[model samples]
Target chain A: MIETFRRVLRRLGSVETTSVLIVLCAVIALLGIFLPIRTSNWMVLPFALLMANLLAALATNARLKSQSMLFAFHAALVAVIVLVGLDRLHAMHGRVEVAEGSMFDASAVAAEHGLLHDLRLGEVRFLQGPFEITYAPGMKRRETESVIRIPEQNGGWREVRVGDHTPLIFGDYRFYTTHNKGFAPIVTYVSASGDSRTGAIHMPSYPMNENKQGLAWTPPGATKPLKVWLHIPEPVFDEAKAWKFVKPTNTRLVLIDGDERHELSVGEVVSLGSAQLRYDGLRSWMGYTIVGQSMIHWIAAASLMACLALLGHVLSVLIYGSRIPAAGAEHGG
Target chain B: MALEPAPRRRRRSHLIAAALVLVVIVAAGVVLEKMPGSGPTVATAPQQSASSGVTPFGQAFAKGIEAMRLGDAHTAARAFDEARAINPHIPEAHVNLGFAFLAMQRPREAATAFDRALSIDAKQINAYYGLGAALDASGDRKGAIGAMRTFVHLSDKKDPFQRKAMSALWEWEAAENGATPQQGEADAKSKPEAAAAKDAAAGETTASIEQQGGAGTGAKPEAVATKDTAAAEAPAPSEQKGEAGAKAESTAVAMLDTARRNNAPVPPPLPAIADMPDALTPPEGVISIVNVWASWCGPCRAELPSLQAFAAALDPSRYRLVGLNVDRDRDFAREFIRDTAVSFGNFWDGRGVFAKARFQVEAYPQTLFLDSSGAVIARVSGTREWPADAAEATVAEILASGQKKEPK
Candidate 1:
């Protein structure tokens, strides 16, 4: 029974098993990205199995105990695999589009996080400020600069300028600016109780559907939905020259009711059903991709150590093997 | 000692490996637990109300435009009437009013507004075309033919409505007689077209009108939008946000202001040194302390010698120190350094240009501390005493896999 168990453990930890697991993981990851199937389970199982195999090898390999360089190499490999498991357990990845002059509330983000993801993102408070984008002659974007405001210990917001090259780093999370920004209109709905709620209505990807800009808004305590459309008076982008990213200076909100038509300009207010709807103004929104991998630094260090150990093992084998064979040949002769 | 202690040696070797693994795990756990932010925040608080701040003309004109856009004949007619009552010379208002009346199937009223617009300007293509369509829809056969003929004569070749006018003329001519056109005049020519077909098709009447005047139906909003000089000249909302957005405003303007107020230029010329690397970017896995100072500043004068001493005592491979002298007087700055008898990489910055623009430094005698990865660890202001051991320990603590230490 002990011999059978020993053979089974050795077989599972063999190089062949690890190679098969790696190939299987790669295929499943590709399927997860391209196919509309639940392939995450398939991936997790193999990676978990591979990590167990590495651990088994560390415990049972008797030669690795005597050979210090080989032992260190295998130990480094174990460390790397363990870090990968920890990363999968705690990593988070998500995207959020924050409107200018608006606070980035963590709960509002649509994100995917690992099971053990720590949800204490409130330590760094960020208020998105107005961003600027420069365009080439044909309206091709050349540069993008997003300004972020962080709360200072002394109570005022400290400005941090972030561009494509300069990413905002908070803890293990890194925020990169992507080419996914558009315009957002500030809409205020004043209820019959005189209570007002202000929110940003982000448009469908801009220039993607430049002619269409609208949203359906229902005031508090009202059953009927108000039909709202953004009535821009001019071309947002000029073909002749570079233009600044500015909200329509005279954006008009066209509201439709039952046989009633109302146009409210920027800073305009009018009555709707039992409430007063105000078009406070327009603002721009910026998109950001946020990634959290807390164990990446440890993984990188482990990888470096693994490479060094492998080098040491190779050198030791070359030197000692050559010396022993030559000394034996001379003695035999 | 070596031969008798095999068990002890094995235990000691195991202890080292165990300690390494434990240290790494603990460090990773601490870093993840203390990282800034983990999720989104909920913003549900009510904001202040936007009070009455509309211009009488802007509001009324906007109402007229929106009503027209919505294809609401009665509401649009009332809004346009209000606008004309306020100022009797807006020809666009009359043209839009005619469109509204025509959409309502009030041909006589539509014809009257269209005629009034033509009288104001004979070349008003919309008025001429609308008059012809209105006349045809009202069953006035001869009048419709004549009005359409006039419209075809007066309209430009590139006018979008010209081709529609010709097609409608042929149909009206056929309708006058007993010949049947492809589409009945009652179905095609009687209705005004909507720019956005789906949105305007909310009502049966709007859908009908939307089909008749299909000129601006697919046209861009900029083409359909009237060139309202009043609206064009009005101040943008961003300007208005300046005073109202006191809690926040444009970041560019704020950045510019900070740049202007930071470090001003000093007089006299400072000599350039060849020893220091630009920005004092330390090599990988090494800590760097960049001290920015000016000769005229009293705090900076006092802090130089100790920093030099501390720099010399630190392990060369792990730590580096650079000094930035901001006095423009090269001789004076050089003399100050010589008199202090300090050694370490030092460079001359006569105007505080690099420090102010890049690091947003607002004061003299500022020191920037950096970690091994070249990330800004912390920036200390005023004067700091850097005894070698204390600085080294702090750097090591920062490098450890644990909770982030507050920058000194």
Candidate 2:
């Protein structure tokens, strides 16, 4: 058994055995492209068996004077194959869908924005077909004023579809839509006592202007001149109040402690006493997007690149060895 | 020294081979690592409100469109309502719902639906058309004309539907505006003949009218009214001649004016005949796999090799693979097939008949696997790996089974 093992080890380090292994690896690589790795696992057993046979064939070959580089190359190939197998076995993947006009953060929105929390959501609504459903995250329930009926398309309802770039995040999971808009409403609250405030609010607020006719009322008067401006454009504005409507402006506002005023923009948020306000800018209603990648995939990719580079170097040396010129007839021919 | 050099060369060859193998192994490993897995598993929660489903309003809208096309007005309305319930901001649902109402002949409800759609999306063309139709059905010709005029203003003149709609709007406007005392007297004198002629013309004009509001164009109403009146005065055969004569005279005059203005070629009259081949039926008794593909689909291009191999390996007597090219340009499809050296039968499906009616395929490289009886058995809608052995096995299994017919 010891002799047989030695013979196999010697064969594994032979040129013919290496050539067979090369063919085997090529075939496996080609197969990997076409078939799911899970279903293609059956091919791996045969490949291993073939590898063993090649090693056995190499054991009987005459020992070359130098074998370090060849052995290193073979070892590298084995290492890559083993690592890939492990990666395929352990990899994990999934998808997420995000709605339009919604925001999602896995960490504290406050830490990043220098507000209070890692993530902050304004107002969120779901647009299915004719039905509109508004959701308040704090309440964890639907709001009565949120449901709105929309027009249909082609005698049916219009749908918001998502793709990779367009994602709708509810909580942690994100949904992407094929088509998305880059507009969001900015809600600013002004206290009654003339205290000005600004921040990003989710839903459309009463229109604000110098006259403040369209603006929503400030908390019952304490006198610092207060108003709440909802900056997002409504799909259907009241015809009578049409003149007051303005295109959603990037400018956002928030009143801190009903005293200090801060203007926020996209990717910024303001802090009010006990309540954190974020200016989540407007984005188009895109659907869910699923990202299917794992750490193992990255590791495998890096290893493969290294192997390819090493292979190229080895090939160059073999094709242009110094002995070729010496073996040929002298120029005096 | 020679012996040592020989050994070195042998070692080098071994290294090269081993290195190649290593590269292959590493490449496979890297690809496996980079291979994107199925997207994150959607957290399956307990049954929640319908709104909680991540289904977008767009998909619901598409469903509503499908229901409407099937002539299920009630279902279409329900779908629209569901879509609106999900996203009230989309204007398509209201317009489609109004269309459904119009189909059900509920003019008031239809008008309201159109109003709602317009309120959401002022530029929506269908809403205006539905509004006009509802008004016309309710005998409010003036309101209908106003709506139709808006539709015409928003439509492109070169579009076939737009041209047809313009003609209808013009005729309707003309008939309403051209109520001369003489025409009224004549109509009163021969009400029966006039009514009969109007009935005959209605059939020919309905499609044009429906198309008109959607394609908005401001066509001259006077000429259209004259044509309508003439059609009402004559019998069906005589009406055709009168209409043809009027069209020729008007078209000739328009052409002359156009030529003089720009020194350009005279434009052709209406009903420009298109040079396209009539639809051909696939061979009988063979399962025709119609693959709708564009040259742009990477998956489609990748799968071509496998498909070609399958085609080469298959018994042509048992199956037929037909590629229905849905490209905007026919030459592109031809060139692609030629460059790829694909040996499968190909045809242009420019009319989008198969796409619209049978499969409703929205994505490219969609394959509809048909049974020998010419019924669709299965569909592979996206790019996928086709293992030769597995495919052959599936084909054999399909052949062996007695259940060859697909359920309609």
Candidate 3:
């Protein structure tokens, strides 16, 4: 059994076995790219095998063991692969939309995360403030300047302006502004039973669904839902000229209940059968793409170290050739 | 005994180094675990719940339909749910509920509802379209294409949604083949069935439910969107004559003949103006309705009478109606307008620059609703009966929206 184990280790440490493992990893990676398989879990197998093979090679290969630079290079490569694996295990991607003046609710976010992702989004608290977005002609979105307020050590708030490029980082997570802003109608609802509540209804995205600016909403206290359409009497933006994102002041909520349609302006009230709706005003909402922090820096560092060690080993071999004394050569001499 | 073997010593040192590296990595992991914000927490998805009541199925279904017509998918869903609770066998309720869920962006629930509808009634045509759309949204393109194909096969050729389904199928197939819809459409020309489907070709097909030639039960499924409700209106006298109507005018033809006598390809209807006028820049407090039209466009000529009447009836203080003639040959446009007796302020778009660039118009007879600031409030493609109440109601809605902006 001991002899068999030694033979297996020797085979695993062989260059031919390393080449086969590498080819298998490449094949798996290619399959992942071409096919619709999730590579996150599948990648761990090949990497783990490669790491084991490398360790076996480090232990059994006498010539390799004698070379410190080559050994260090291989060790750095192992570290890089391990770091990348850990990173993949904990990475996450998410998206959230917050209306201006609203608090960022972590629970409202839609995300996909790895198995070991630390869900600490609840610790990240911030409030969305006013944001400005510009558009070029033909409705091509340009820059976005979103203002967000984060809590400070002192009970006050510290304001930060983040945009498409900049991210509002919170520990390991980052919130980046995306080009998905739209109109949000703030409305107050009063049920026939005298219960009242108010909130904003985020409409469909602007310019993209400019004509279809309608949404079906159920009020807080109402039994029946109502359909609300934002009616803009004037041009939203000129396709011929550059423009900025702004809420139209001259817009009304066209509320439809059953067969009845009533138009309401700001502060105006319209009665449905079971409830009454009051148009408070219109506001804007911004969409954000969220990403968890990664181990990319460590991976890059390890890779750089590996490259340097490999370069040093190559230079040593080029300069000294086989004259570089092996471990037994020095002692035997 | 005193001197350890050099190879063994070196191996032990390598082991120590490997152990140290392992210890360091483990330590780093431990530090990271102990770092701030690494606490155990669970992310919760937003939840939505609906309440049901003890209501009669008939009343609930009616309420659902009314709510759907009003665009209230939530209420419609609830009502349908209530109706389904009272009577789970009704396929229409399930179908409508599926559509409501679709409107709410819950494609999974919509698919379930559509599946239920299909389980109840295999021939529920609307359910197939809803199922296809839901499946498509849920990233099941193959299933979506299958469902849409089934819908097209089961539906009448004249069914309005059949054309939409055909368009969707073409898009999906094109996507699957790594080609564009235009390319798919080009390929479709060879297949007779696809050609029949392609004949509709968006913004041109004018078949209505009555023209379905008595296919199925004739139970019209409610439109998912409220836009383009006027697309099914009957054609006008000019539309009945089609392109031949443009040649009906004696004076217009005579002027064209005069241009033909000169051997010039229909010279300018009148003396060539130095420069074409710019697009309509609305005055303060006035809303402008720019009707983009061309003499060659049959639908443009068909809707001219209603537009003329609607323009005449508009309140001059608040609204201004104008014509954007995109006819390349100025003679045809000038004579056509003269023959038609259209008096609205006509601006020439001989080169179609403003029509294409400013309005982004693809089809003719598109009306742009611009505010006093010359910002486009809305763009209605295709034709609508201008004299109808729907048109007036649309304008009234716009007027109501702008009421707050009126100078106090």
Candidate 4:
């Protein structure tokens, strides 16, 4: 039985096993990408098997004394794979867009966590500051600048620049700027019960749904829906490129129920027959692509080591290995 | 023996070195684990509670339809919504809700309603048509194509919406250039029937069209994403070092930009412009609309073609229309113009420095209207339906005014 187990290990660590696993991994990855399979599920098995194979190769194959470079390369490859596994176990990628001047919170984020991920994002705290963009004469956007405000230990919000190239790192999550940013209209809906609730209405994507600026909003406690749009005389998109992000000032919320449409500007109220709505000023939202991964540095280091060791291995074989063989030939002669 | 001993020594040394390297790699990973930037603290946050969305259906739904037939979408929405409150699972209710939402210009909600309708009853073929129209109007071109393709698939050629669905599918298919053209191939290979039915080849001829005269040239909208299309949207150069997770996540995150989304080709970023025009004034005796726009602006991109088309229809003798280009890269702007076939004169709005300083040109694609005397008459901010339904009548009216002499 022991001998059989040894044979199994031998086969498992063999190059043929590695090749098969690689091909399987490729196939699985392709299916995950083009098909409906969740990539994490498809990848885990091959990766786990690869890890075992790599460890077996290290244990049974290495000579344990001389070619440091070749050894380092294999070691680095192992580290990279292991680190990647850990990353997969705990990593997550999600997104959150905070309305400007609003606090970033858990409820605002839409996240999908990994299988083993313990989300500790409750501590992640930041407020969105004002953002700016620049455009050339021909109306091509040139630059984008957004600032994120974090509460300082001293009780003030410290600001940091975040843009297309700059990401905000808070609580192990890296927030990158994506191209999805737009307007949010703040309005207070007064129910028939005389209770008013205020909320933000995020418009459909700008310039994309620019012509159609309303969403169907069924106010809390109200059975009937109202079509609401922040009808700015012109959306404050003029501030960009000459570009600073801004809510369109003096914009009115046009509430439509059937053919009955009434406009209400800031601090003004429009009656919804049984209930009323107040136009609270408009606000803007900047979209962010959020990511959390474990051991980024370890993975990066392992990759660097792998490259260097491969180069060293190549040189040693080409330049030094040739010397030893020639020297042996001379001695034989 | 001497030569053999030396080769053996080298091999042994190499193995030992490899073992040591392994130790070091492990140690480095440990060190990284201890670092602040590596991982999040292990704290289990409570998951957000799921909504109990199942409502029962009854009388109020029927009540809402009366307002609907009278062309009062508001009433229809209320009635359908009431029916929804009682029972949320009915696909038919959602379909009517979608229509009511569309009537009220609430395309996103209409889309949500249609999507909900489909989720409940996948066989609700009309929901696909509603989804297509809503997605298309909402500027979700890729989503619109997918929904339309499904509509075309499930719909008979004689269906009223079938031809329109085909037209929309063809337009987006060309725009996407077969972004999802290989669903059947990938599915046939991988056997994910449900996903394949939804993904790949907005124009693939996998499913045979129902036998009828004048079915659209067989272009089907495929699923939300494919690996090839995902790769196409991914950031270049980084992709070489990128893992499978990053590639998939990038596509997913990009799609999540909107509720349901697709990626369009992005114009490369460029340097800021050097100059800003001093005035966005109109020429004398010509009523004008100085449309300020940037290349990066999504709405501006969609609106420009319509503006160009509108300009083409107008008599140049009475209309002075100018596009204010605020793109930083002049060359890219020219490329965009050429690609979009924009013929009108466009001036640079460098950083919008001049416009902001002169006029309160705060929004993108803002149309500043001017009467014949080059005097600014009005500022149309936000998004405008350039011609609205009155494009022809409006243009004719403007031409007549331009021709008439003012009372002395």
Candidate 5:
């Protein structure tokens, strides 16, 4: 037993063995780019074992001028690989499909845990879910009844929805929804001939500014041209008012009656003596989008940097070892 | 001899490195093979049809052509509308859609579609012709003539069909001012009939042109001679008859000569409008409503029904409604309209200007309400409600007061 141990140690400490180990490590680093190490719990143990074997092999090799530097560089690489493997064990990710006319809450679980992260919302169903949820940088979810369900890898799901944008950091993985168009404008049309008719119409919602003009429809050969205006719910008021292109919060359509004038609210109908007009509902909502927070993306980005560092270190060692005379031959006496 | 061990160890290490590199190469190749392919595949699956995959704009274009060929301005208008929903950049779609509107007797819509097509693609040939056709149909003869002159300038004069169509259109313009070839033929036919009527009144004998067999070739010359001789003699009934006969002979020759020179084949008379696809036949216990609208049409935009409300109120089993959008931009149309809770299908009419030429539509927001038998029970040309107790009230009435349709 003692003799076999001695022979094994001697072989491992040889210059030839050190050269072979360097070649093997370089090949493994290259392989990592394509067939990435499996980070799941089941694969973690095998990965650790492989890493331990590499460390042991590196440690037993004879010391040369650059040996300590190479060892330190490789040691850092192993540390990163182990850390990433642990992260994979805890990381969570999946996809979900929400049908038209439905709102999906992605925060139901995170709310219970009192955690929140930025969210993304895309294409709301006009009737069922009027608004798509999204998150801004550093935004957090407030407590609410809104529920969103996100799928988990282990055949479970997480719930989330509006009002949750931060404090929900589970491992390195965070969740987001797609951004989509959300603003829906309500338009009202009043006929000019004092018969107060009103209709409800919808227009695409634009960024909030008080200056945007509302669109109105005119009927063929109507006694009076259609008098049209828009009603925004939350009117942004300003004194200087340089930017009039911004949509107003409060808009009303005023029509002239023979003797009296009448005003129609957005999405309201009025009858002015036979010339019926009404405020039409929104035609469309535009310009909503969903995006992920930069932080989570940054965490995944670190793995790439580690990979590049290992690649550079391996190349330098290979080039230096090939160009210089063998250290073992020079030391021979 | 001393180099033997070093050389053997070096060779062994080199072989191991070479093997490791080969393994890495093979593994990378395998992984690359599994990577996703770039872009969408154009090779359609066997189950998919070319027509089904066509964008909304293409579908509207094809439908407009089909409608024009069949002379059903309304149906053609609806189809062109579907095409415009897929793509608005296609100017031809708008031109053809306008033609459909024109044929439906909606001149205003035809003009708008033509104008829109020209705005998107200035060199659109069909839009120019459709504009002329719409103007001609709408009682704006001078405008029609001007548009036709533009059409003539733009058209390839070398094409036989186009040349004939241009000549016929010009002739129609001329005829509107004075006597036409058809009118000349009628006058010729009338002269003989008048001679017969005069003979009955005067109690005198008149030579029947039909009786002059083989003398047919000499008929014109003899008729002229007889007219001169009678004029020289006395103011008798025969002299009056001879003058009418000579005029009739000249008119007939002119008519025949014009026909020969133009080599113009008379087009079959316009098909009865009712013979066209009136509307989609609704299932039993259902009312089929077709709403014709355009994106730029303000009133049409205002009166757009709350799809959700309509879908909720109307029992799908009893009522079906379709929106026939005449929008020039397919993306804008789809994005704007898709959010509505309308359960029924939508169609695009591609005849931008020609819709008016083909459909004779005078305005937008035209609602054609049809019964289950597909017969148009009533039509609302503007934004107004049908009487509360009429066959069915308009969408505005239903949403405002929760008005329900009484059973027919």
Candidate 6:
């Protein structure tokens, strides 16, 4: 039994084993980069083999133990690998549209996250304020600056400015602004039973879907929902000249309810049976990309430290003689 | 000296490192769980009412309303809060508290109070209005408009607060339309003389139609809805001038308001006819009877003669009768109209825009009754023999039902 275990350890600790594992990891990584696979599952076996090889080398190879710098360098590399795997398992990416003067709702986010990602987004509370976006001639969008209000620890709000490049960082999550924005028609529906609900109907993306700015919505306690379209009678801004994004004027909300159509101005109400729907006004909604639980910074730091330690080890080796003689014969050198 | 082997020592150190990593991970998880803002909180309110007779709760509630009416907002707020503490389920206390907060110029707090009131009883109409006002003051103009619109929607037409809410909502919405709030206010306050002149003209037209009908038949037609009891008992037409005319007009308006509150479905204007020809356009400022027809439908072909006779017999000054052709081919519809010798101006629904899906035209030869503002207020389905006398009475009834009055 002892001989079998010893033989296994020797094979795992061989330099050939390390080289084979490294080659396998590199091939898998190359495939991941080139192929359409989005999951990290395919690389797990290669990583496990590399980790096992590192552990066996630490156990069976005496040269690594003799040099502290070399050992620290390899240890940092192991830490980097572990942290990267952990981050991949826990990372989350999501996108959400929040209207101005409205609180951010986590439930409204369309998201994708790793299986191990702990969803604590609901805990983050903030209100989005008005955002400004400038457009160059020919409708090229520029930088967006959005203001947000976050509650402080002691019963007040702190104003934070977030832009395209600058993210609103809250604990482990960061919200970055995106170019996707459009008008949201604020409306209120009052049911016959007196249940009133107010919500914003986010129109299709501006300019891109300018011609087809309509959606179907069902009111509370109604059997049938109506199709509502925002009709801007005239051009909001000139695309030929540089302009800023602003709400359009003289807009009408056209509602099509089975065999009937009603065009409502702002503050105009239309009755659907006993219930009523009112088009309050319009507000702009900003789209934000949310990233959470990423360990990229830690991984970068560990890699840099490992590189420095490797340099130090190389310098020490050139200056000094063999430390308890190199285990070259055992390594098959 | 007896010592452990180098491999054994290394293996032990590896085990120790692995254990340390596991411990660190566990510690991190525990810390995260115990951290503040990690857990979500659920709001709970007492569902059942506790008030029975006059108690401290009643006294506090009464005090709040009295203080509010006296314009002592601070005192009202305190009393409402006291009433809420005594019985948290009372929605009125929360609504009054919201109003009090609004009076205090603390809109955010007022919004919260209104929200709480809504949670207790969603039917609290005043809470929605207060919430809108609070949101507007707090710079959430959209939310304010939503709340006020909902209030107007639920409130009775004669509710004193209804006018105020509508005026405020118009001002806010006008501001959104690139106009100053004051400009919106001014626009809302001003009533056009043109509208009054149109009403007067409409009254004269109805009276002339009545005189031409030569005796009233009390038979209620489907096209002329007199759903309100008061509308049925309305006074007969009399030639009153000046002060008497103004008083009659006021009475007519009140009766119309009551009829509107009886859940009358007011259809909006048809989609813009940019693609359609100008000949198809119905004239504005007069009641229009649009007769929908298709060349293929036998009933539509049969009704063409009666529609022609009805149009010829009607006084052209008060009412305009037009024909909507739903035939796929415009030439076919024109040829059919020419064949029938129908002189009325005909519009071809070539795009099928005025098909069964649009105007609920379940059958061919359906007639739509459009008010002076071009809103389709009523409809008459199937073919009917156009007797000049019955047609005049129908027109008179539609006019008397306040169809000419613009929707509020």
DockQ of each: 0.03, 0.05, 0.02, 0.07, 0.02, 0.03
User: Which candidate leads the pack in TM-score?
Assistant: 1
TM-score of chain A of each: 0.82, 0.34, 0.83, 0.84, 0.32, 0.83
Fnat for every candidate: 0.02, 0.08, 0.00, 0.15, 0.00, 0.00
lDDT of each: 0.59, 0.45, 0.64, 0.58, 0.43, 0.63
What lDDT score goes with residue B251 in model 3? 13
lDDT of 5 at B49: 11
> What's the TM-score of every candidate structure?
0.50, 0.25, 0.47, 0.47, 0.24, 0.45
Model 5 ranges off by over 4 Å: A13-19, A27-84, A88-172, A175-333, B1-143, B152-408
* Candidate 1 C-alpha error for residue B139, in Å: 22
In order, the TM-score of chain B in each prediction is: 0.35, 0.35, 0.35, 0.30, 0.31, 0.34
Task: Put down candidate 6 lDDT per residue, A1-333, tens digits, no spaces.
Answer: 987896687688767899999898887778888886526566588788888888777656667655556666767677778878888789999999998768899999998887799889999898777788989999999978887877666756677778887888877788998988898888888887889998888887886665456767777667777777776655678879998888876465666665434445565555554566777777878999999958776676666667766887799988885744585344433
lDDT tens digits, residues B2-113, model 3? 9999788777767665554455455555565554431122232222111122226655765664454344557867988997887887666777677667656677897898
Error of 2 at B61 (Å): 24
User: Backbone clashes in each candidate structure, one number apiece?
Assistant: 18, 101, 4, 61, 129, 0
Top candidate (lDDT)? 3
Q: Relative to the unseen true structure, what is the C-alpha lDDT of residue A322 in candidate 5, on a scale of 0 to 100?
A: 74
Model 4: number of backbone collisions: 61
For model 6, state the Cα shift of residue B334 in Å.
Answer: 26
lDDT of 4 by residue, B3-55 (tens): 66865776677666666666666666677666553122222222222122111
Off by over 4 Å in 2: A8-13, A31-39, A46-73, A103-333, B1-408
Candidate 2 per-residue lDDT, tens place, B1-408, comes to 245676567667776755665666556756784444222322221222121111455445545544543335566578777877877765656665665565565767867877887897788665665577677666777887787678768844542234434544665667698843344554454433322222222222223322222110111222434444545554254343223222212222222222222222212111101222212223565666667776656677778888777766656786667677665544334434643556676776654455645567778888766754446676676866655556656565644555444453
The number of residue pairs in model 5 that clash at the backbone is: 129
Candidate 5 docking classification: incorrect
RMSD of each: 26.6, 26.1, 24.9, 25.3, 29.2, 23.7
User: What global local distance difference test value does model 3 have?
Assistant: 0.64
